[model samples]
Target: MSLINSLLLLFIAILISYLLVQLMQWSNLFDKWLDQISKKEDPSFGNDTEGLLEVVETLPQFTVSDISGQLIGIQELIDNKKTLLIFLNEECEFCGSNFEHFSQLINNYKGKKNIQVLFQSNQKETARNFYDVYDGKFSVHLYKKEVISEVGINFFPAYLIVDPTHSIDLITHNPIQVAHSLNFD
Candidate 1:
């Protein structure tokens, strides 16, 4: 009788332990799901997270058309110079506000480094007008609407620095920090 009671107690303890472990796992999964939902609701949620450049092993090659309808390859853009690639949306308010700052940065770096602005919009004329109005001093390109997805960018006003060796680095979302990262004023 004593031996049976001991075995029964041991069995109950093991079952309870298993239940607790499963409950903890389920709770953790629930918490993660909530976090994801909240992040999706917040536009700027993931902007502070580490960007793709930290994880990607290689930069993909791409070709885009400049404002003047010239076909420019990524390699040609970065040829023998450190290139600052600014991805913008003509419709985005934040992007619109930063146009002058970007133009100023490009002007400051003119003849020293390559600065290119890639507008991710379907309206080529709108992009051209924006560039013209701002007196943009950098090479301006109109990217295909799908280029954003192709490059894995989730936000506009994103910055990428391509070194002379063609290696790419992602600057943080802060414009001041991005300018500093490129050693620009």
Candidate 2:
């Protein structure tokens, strides 16, 4: 091959390699980038540190059904008080466990009269069954599958702590992890 042709191929290869590297970095394929930038520990990524529990600028609201088939609006539920929202699915095993943990927390803070516990389930009957199985007397509302996407939920058993205006204060997948940081016990 001619030297000019060889050099041209070399240049093309280098450009492709640079493009690939840039794509990976942009897509979060480089873990070291997160390690260097993230506030959490590099090795352990421990939950001991309090996460960013910021007040959300805009709140997403949806209407779901209660066990009794009563329409429940998330914004309406909060009224003027903070809300502890538990998003659960009957198919999720961890959600069941979280339900029990939430029950205890609810009982502990019963007299506070400011925070409301809302369990969002895919099915009304399924949620009711869980409520009955755990002997959970707390009321829950059933959410549709589309509603889940509407609220930008991509994980199961998500726990959202919202302030008086229905603005999110904290959003976490691990309720226990968040509870520990917040001294739920």
Residue 155 of model 2 has an lDDT of: 50
lDDT of candidate 1 over 38-132, digit per residue (tens): 55333343334343323332346788788878888877887767778788786554576565675565455434656788876476787698678
The TM-score between candidate 1 and the true structure equals: 0.63
What residue pairs are clashing in model 2?
none
Candidate number achieving the greatest TM-score relative to the actual structure? 1
Best candidate according to lDDT:
1
**Residue 75's lDDT in candidate 2:** 76
Candidate 2 Cα errors over 4 Å, as ranges: 1-57, 105-110, 113-122, 134-136, 180-185
For model 1, how big is the CA root-mean-square deviation? 16.4
In model 1, pairs of residues that clash are: none
Give the Cα lDDT of each candidate.
0.66, 0.59
